[model samples]
Target chain A: MKVVGLYEYLPIEAQESFLDVIVDTPKASGHDLLVRIQAISVNPVDTKLRASKVTVEETPRILGWDAVGIVTEIGDAVELFQVGDAVYYAGDVTRPGSYAEFQLVDEHLVGAKPINLSIEEAAAMPLTLITAWEALFDRIRINPDADAGKKLLIINGSGGVGSIATQLAVWAGLEVITTASRDETITWSKQQGATHVINHRKPLLPQLKALDLEGVEYILCLHNTDAYWDAMQEIILPQGHICSVVELQNPVSMSLIKDKSVTVSYEFMFTRSKYNTDDKVRQHDILTKATQLFEKGFLKTTLNHVLTPINAATIKEAHRMLESGKSIGKLVVKGFEENDEQAN
Target chain B: MKVVGLYEYLPIEAQESFLDVIVDTPKASGHDLLVRIQAISVNPVDTKLRASKVTVEETPRILGWDAVGIVTEIGDAVELFQVGDAVYYAGDVTRPGSYAEFQLVDEHLVGAKPINLSIEEAAAMPLTLITAWEALFDRIRINPDADAGKKLLIINGSGGVGSIATQLAVWAGLEVITTASRDETITWSKQQGATHVINHRKPLLPQLKALDLEGVEYILCLHNTDAYWDAMQEIILPQGHICSVVELQNPVSMSLIKDKSVTVSYEFMFTRSKYNTDDKVRQHDILTKATQLFEKGFLKTTLNHVLTPINAATIKEAHRMLESGKSIGKLVVKGFEENDEQAN
Candidate 1:
């Protein structure tokens, strides 16, 4: 199968940062689905992993996570998916990724693609949707039907996860307050169902105070956690819950929230598959719900940009755009070139 | 009314550290209940407050949170209790406390005293019970009935909160593992219903490994958070929850748990009272349930040491014992001297 991978970690400016290569296609076994990748989304994680390379690999390292594909083969133990079914998933981090023509993924992490959306649109959602879903429902344990009158603040509301999180939180009946700096991004956040918008470039407390919000009941941070640490400590409600996707560069004072009894959780999206936890199948359930919601008009894909001919050049450009840190929503690469195909 | 209080922060060794004073009894208003104090428990917070006094008060500053007393009068708005009702409560820290002949407390924070225990015995439970109850059920959101086959680790398992937390976790059907440094403390931890006990004075990882345990699903920390932090990071299962009652003396690297998506929460028993939150009445509900549990023998009072004739001298001595940091379970004082009381 044809693949776009890296032999050594290098900046996007390097000509050889991403390469087109050929590798033996993996076969499905033990609940695995051999997927024929059709489209893949580029996220910040892809850029981060590309830049954080420490050791040179003997073989090219594939680096995609979010994909919309068709299951071409299934393991005997597979129960959730079958051959020739359209599927979408943010596959396991420990395995070879979806940046290839053929990839094997655990069926438990795969979900049926939304019938109303294109493959590129579906590709943009799996990773960010799973992240936002787990952060709100699993980690924070917010009951969509019960938590009325509560409020949520989404930091960096123009990002992929923030776009989906804003809509989901609002659908769950929370008064959503989102942060966006640029005018276009602010308008996009409002269009995604944010009840209020604040600028991340300015002091959050003053903006929140103007909105008559003393402290938010929930905060989902997609931006720099260390930068927002003090603000989160001051403005989270007593007994509030905070979930962040970003890693901290510096140590944080855990004692800051001691008096208020606050909960701080990390939402890595890959924890279930990384740990092979007993409830790993819940991811499939979450994505299945996402499909139903999307088909019913309760959700729309966050894909804002797309590139054709999934190849070294396009993937590198997607990574560069993500690294620039100005992209509003998800960016996807689709359509394998006719000359790049090594298999059907 | 006669009271024992401090006009300034002082070492317990000082003869005038605690002084006996006379003040007019406070009247009940709003949600307040005027209680005639019968017994009180001394916790580490009391000793810390005594040692860290920074400001001189014009009037004596009374400090006692855990008390078992009779409701002498009820405010017009009080509905949970009427006159002459025997109650137990960890009173608000903002109000003048129970180191007096009579004290006024919010009725929402008071609970019916357990009929099966002595006054001093019941006093040992209110504060610690609230802390443990909130930490497990409210903060960590552990469903006592549903979390079967799971495990919990309680650090400093012989301390006031740890002692009660151990029992409550066991009652909730969790296999409880606790840490105790001394032989007596270890025995006390076992007596409080710990399924297993380890020494905290030694390295925790090796001890847990020797018990054939890789990680725990839930961890309730009653000791120094900074001290046991690394061990908690290593031993908490992926996506596990950890709750601590102690404030960290140093900053913690939040990035350490990023890969595992761990949740860290602070469990301050006074949060509801401190914030006057909408769910402040939950504390009263917890204590009421605790009374039933204590009566049915599902839980037991953790009071380990007692002093008679509540007075300035005895309170100062209690402070001395607590400051030594060697006291096990709870230290309580009861029955004021005949000559000290200005009220019957």
Candidate 2:
């Protein structure tokens, strides 16, 4: 199969950054399903991984996490899926990823694509939706049913993950307070179910006090976790919890949380697949529920920019938009160009 | 009323570290209860608070938290107890503590003392039991129904709080593994309720691995948190949660928990009283339940040593033993010498 893989960690401008190469696409085995790639989404993780210090691999390493695809073959042990099934997943973090014509993914991590949406639309939801879902429900352990009046503040509401998070929290019946700096993004955040929007560039306490809330019960941080650490610490209710998806470059003081008996949790969407955890099948469950919500029109597709005839030119354009730090929901590259569609 | 207050953060040998003073004991108002103090337990938290710098207060501040006494009067809004009720409590962190002949406490924070144990034994329980109960059932959020087969590791077993937490975890049917270094502590920990005892001073992962375990499902850190950051990260199960009560002097890396989606909570027992939270009555409820458990002999007092004729001499002895870090379980101080015979 024709695959996008890298031999070295290089800057995006480098000639050999990501190359089109021919590699053997393996047959489905165990619980794996061989997926014929349809659409793929680029996230910040893809760029960060490309710049990591890990040395060049003996074989070219494919790096893509989010993809919407169709199953062409099914493994003998797979009970959840079969051939000809349309699927969407944020695939395994340790093994090969989803940047290819054909890929192998565990059936437990794959979810059926929403019938109401196209492949590019479905591809954008898996990684960010899964992350936002687990951050609120699992990591922060919000009781959406019993505590409908509880307040949640989603920091960085205009970003890829935050857009989905704000909608999901509102759908679950919690009042949503989100942070957005730009006027357009602030207006967009309100449109996407945020009850109130604050500027992330400023301090949060005075804003919360103005909202007639002394503090919130939970905080979901999507961007610049270390920068918002102390602010979240002070505004979180005593015994409240905070969850963050962004990785911090520096240490976070454990003291900031200890006095109030608060908890801090990290929600990484790839954890289940990375560790091959026992409850890995739950990802499939979550995606199925998310699909139901989407089909019922409770959720809208977060795809904002779509580049067609997925060639090196269009892929590089999507990557640059992401690198610029101003990309709003998601940038998707769909349908491989005929010239680069050579199979292995 | 007679009070024990400290004018400065002085060494134990300073003779004037704790002084006897006379103050006008305020009448009960709002939810406050006026209690005539009898016996008290000295915890490490008390010592730490006494030694802490106090630049804001011009006068000597009363410093104590845990006590068993008789309720003399109740405020207009106090509904939990009546006059002459034998009570035990750990008062609020922000107010004058239980270090005086007559101390005022929120009625919701006090509980009916156990009918079976003596006052000294009851005094030793509140601060530690509250910390233990919240850490296991609330912060770690263990459902007794769901936690039956899970492995739980409690660091620093046989300490003030650990002794009760191990017992409570065992009662919840979790397979309890606790850490203790000394021979006596190991035996005491097993007697208290640990199913397995590992030396905390040694590397914990190899020890856990030797037991045919990759990691534990939960870790309750009752020791120094900064020192055990790496080991706690390594020994925690994928998607596992951890809770700690110790405060770290420096920032600890939050990224250690990022990849696994692990959560870390700080279980400060004083949060409810300090914040006047809506759930303050739960402390009264928990203590009432604890009293029942004690009367039925299902719970055991951690009080291992006692000093009579509560005065500067005996209090200093207790402080020295605590600073030595070799004292086991709890050290309690009884009523003043002249009142001892009248108390009985």
Candidate 3:
């Protein structure tokens, strides 16, 4: 299999930071599906894991999260997938990722790719869509069956997760207020289903109050958990729920939310898969719904920028773009092209 | 009205601590009730509030959270109380407290005293019962409506709040595992409704494993929030919930809960009454339910000790007893002398 991986942690400026190498492809076993990668997307987790490596690895660590692929082989234990089925998934953190020609993923983590989109477009939908789906539907309990007038604020609504979150919230019929600092990002967020845009650079309270809202019913924080602690504490209504994907560096004063009778929850999409929980298949269910929604025109792909045929320099450039904190949406690179593209 | 308060923050050894004085009896306004206190209970909040002084108060601060009393006056907006109703309540923190002979409380915060219990027993309940109820039914969502057949860990199950929390968890049909260090407390916890008792002095993980359990579904922490953070993080099942009544002085890591998709909520019973939220009267509803539960033998008072004739020295003794961290169950001091008690 043609794969990209790292043997040592180095700055993105280093020449051999991400290498395109070859590893033997393993047979699909149990519920695994051997998929031939068509497109791949990079997320913040990839950049973070890359920068945190302290020791040289015995084997190169393959790093990628999002992918649109075609299943070429299925394990005998698999009932959900078959050879030649098109699929998309955000591969698991503890295993080899999708930066490869052929990768095996659990059937339970794979979703059918949308019929109306190209591979890059479908690739952009999985990771962010999965996170947004879980955060709103699973964690915050927004009812897709009912058309209630619920309001949701998505902090950092122009980022990859936020772009998908804003769309999902709107699809669920919520009044979506999103935060963005730049004018271009704000306009882009509105195009992605945000009803209103507020500046994340300023205090959120006055902006929320100016919008004729005493407090929002739900807040899905996509960035800066510790920074928004005080504002979230002040702006969430009594009994209102808040879910965040960001981790706080310090222990927060949860006491601030005590008087509001509010609920604060963490939304990590990997939980069920990580724990092998009784409800692990729910991820498969969510992804199926997301695929349908995308085809139904309720969701649009968030692939803002796409790089050419996959390689070392391109992978390093993708990481650098994410680290710059200015990427509007997801950045993806697809396929094996120029021969040197595969080498470190 | 006669009142006991601290003009200055003093060590318990000071003779003038919790001094007796005369003050104007406040009139009821809005949802307020002028209650003639019959009995009052000492909780950890009392000692914490007493040991600490208000920089802005020139006179004195009175601290008492729990009370059994007679409603002697009702506010113009009051619909829940009458001039002679017997009541029990855990009052708001930002107000002068029930240490005074006639204290004004919001009617919504008061519940009818249980017909099955005496004044001392009723007095011992309000603070702890409310804390327990909010933690279990509201925050942790144990669902008395469903079979939460899963086990719950109530850390510090012999404390005032824990005594009630254990009972509530049992009432919700959960398998109750509680931690109590002393022999009498362990016995008392079992009597209250604990299925099993573990020693907090021992390592919690080993104790849980010895009980033939892998992990608990919920944990209610009633003491030492900072000290138990790591233990709770380890033993909580993925997607489980945790609630605590105490707030930590320093920040603790919230990231631990993220990977598990777990929820950690703060339960401060004073929240509704303190903020006078739209659902504030729900406290009245809970107290009503609590009274019937107590009378019907579904719940029982946790009063373990009582002091006769509430006075400065007896109250100080109660404070000292709480500070020693040895008191099991609830301790209360009756208002005035038996003959003088009627004088209020």
Q: List DockQ, one per candidate, in order.
A: 0.75, 0.72, 0.52
Candidate 1 ranges with C-alpha deviation above 4 Å: A339-344, B339-344
List the RMSD of every prediction in angstroms.
1.9, 2.2, 3.3
Interface RMSD of each: 1.6, 1.7, 1.8
lDDT of 2 by residue, A116-155 (tens): 9888899888888888888988888777777697899999
lDDT of each: 0.90, 0.85, 0.86
Best by TM-score: 1
Quote the positional error of residue B88 for candidate 2 in Å: 1.1
For model 3, the stretches where C-alpha displacement exceeds 4 angstroms are A52-54, A142-151, A212-217, A234-241, A251-255, A258-263, A336-344, B54-60, B144-147, B251-255, B338-344
Per-residue lDDT of candidate 2, residues B154-227 (tens digit): 89988889899988888788888999999999998999989899999999999998999899999999889888
In angstroms, the error of model 3 at A185 is 0.7
Residue B337 displacement (Å), model 3: 2.8
Worst lDDT 10-window in candidate 1 chain A: A335-344
Give the true-contact fraction for every prediction, in order.
0.84, 0.84, 0.70
**Model 2, residue A283: C-alpha shift (Å):** 0.2
lDDT, residue A315, candidate 1 = 93
TM-scores of chain B alone in all candidate structures, in the order given: 0.97, 0.95, 0.96
Q: Which stretches of candidate 2 lie over 4 Å from their true place?
A: A52-54, A338-344, B52-59
Order the candidates by DockQ, highest first.
1, 2, 3
